[model samples]
Target chain A: EAGVTQFPSHSVIEKGQTVTLRCDPISGHDNLYWYRRVMGKEIKFLLHFVKESKQDESGMPNNRFLAERTGGTYSTLKVQPAELEDSGVYFCASSPYRTGPTGETQYFGPGTRLLVL
Target chain B: AQTVTQSQPEMSVQEAETVTLSCTYDTSESDYYLFWYKQPPSRQMILVIRQEAYKQQNATENRFSVNFQKAAKSFSLKISDSQLGDAAMYFCAYRSASGGSEKLVFGKGTKLTVNP
Candidate 1:
């Protein structure tokens, strides 16, 4: 089966520009998660989507960051007026329903490297 | 709150040898999940292995295995017969199993270098 796929493997934008990162998860997967790692830091969770609903977004840093899962299919993370600290590798992952079998593993995508200048 | 730590920032091992990466976590929750992810030069976070908190026996996949201690909140990865392709950043992660959320809390990561 095809794993999670992300668009624009690399993105470069100015400090005040807007950038959107997209993630297409595996078919039939009900769980989608967003994560990112800044320089010399651990990978931090951003948010999670179960189907089309936002299950958990406590990890979201601020209002400038927004996440949407339209039609409960794919998800998007948009950063407005990006700051220099936003330059990092953003990773998207998905997994099958935990209630069902085989939800222990998460499939990750080729992260999108965002560079803010 | 949960936090994971990887004391060794970098580690090296000769090919065909064994290497262990240490990880410790602090969590009040009894039920949780632990994971080890490998990130190669391509910057892809690949799931190497995982362990359930309730499982007594360790989890193993091929040459990769985890020594998980729930009481101590410690989880370590052991790679046997290390290969050059195994060189990468290994991150230890923790997730609350009962929160109805699958959010993972990761460590600072340990960069493993395999010498041939």
Candidate 2:
């Protein structure tokens, strides 16, 4: 099975520009998540989606950031009027929806490196 | 809220030697999961090993193993016979086993270098 894949492995844009990152999860996986890692910092969770509905979005940093999963398949994270602090590596992960002693293991994609100048 | 910490910013080891990466986490939940992920330069992050809090026994995968101390709230990764390919940024992460929250909490990460 193919792993999670992301589009535009690297993006460079000016501050105040809008950028959209896309992620295609593994086939048949219902759980999708987005995380970001700033330079020299830990990876922080942004949001999660189960199918077409959002499961949790408390981690979202601000109103400028928005994420959507359409048709319960792929996800997109949009940063409008992106600021310099928004530059970082954005990672998307997915896992099968299963409940058991062994919790769901997330598979990550090659993160998209965004640089806002 | 739970937090994960990796004290070591960077570490080095000679090829064929063993190295351990330290991690400490703070969590009140009894049932949870811990993970170690390896991210090589310009590559996707991959899982190295994971340990369920309920399991006393540590988790091992080939040359990679974890020293999980539940009481001490510690989870460390030990790489035996370290290869040059093992050089990467190692991250320690924690996840709650609850039904609603499935997001992972990650540490700042430790960069490992294997000298040949």
Question: Which candidate comes out best when scored by lDDT?
Answer: 2
Expressed as tens digits, the lDDT of each residue in B3-80 for candidate 2 is 999999999999999999999999989999999999999899999899999999999999999999999999999999
**Candidate 2 Cα lDDT to native:** 0.95
What is residue B52's positional error in candidate 1, in angstroms? 1.0
RMSD of each: 1.5, 0.9
| Poorly placed runs, candidate 2 (over 4 Å) | A100-102
Docking class of 2: medium
- lDDT per residue, candidate 1, B14-103, as tens digits? 999999999999998877889999989886789999888888999999999998888888999999999999999999998887756678
lDDT of 1 by residue, A29-113 (tens): 9899999989899899999898999989998999999999999999999999899999999999998876732326788999999
What is candidate 1's DockQ? Answer: 0.63
Taking the true A–B contacts (Cα pairs closer than 8 Å), what share appears in each candidate? 0.72, 0.72
lDDT against the true structure, each candidate: 0.92, 0.95
Over A25-117, each residue of candidate 2 has an lDDT whose tens digit, in order, gives 999999999999999899999999989899899999999999999899999999998999999999999999876535778999999999999
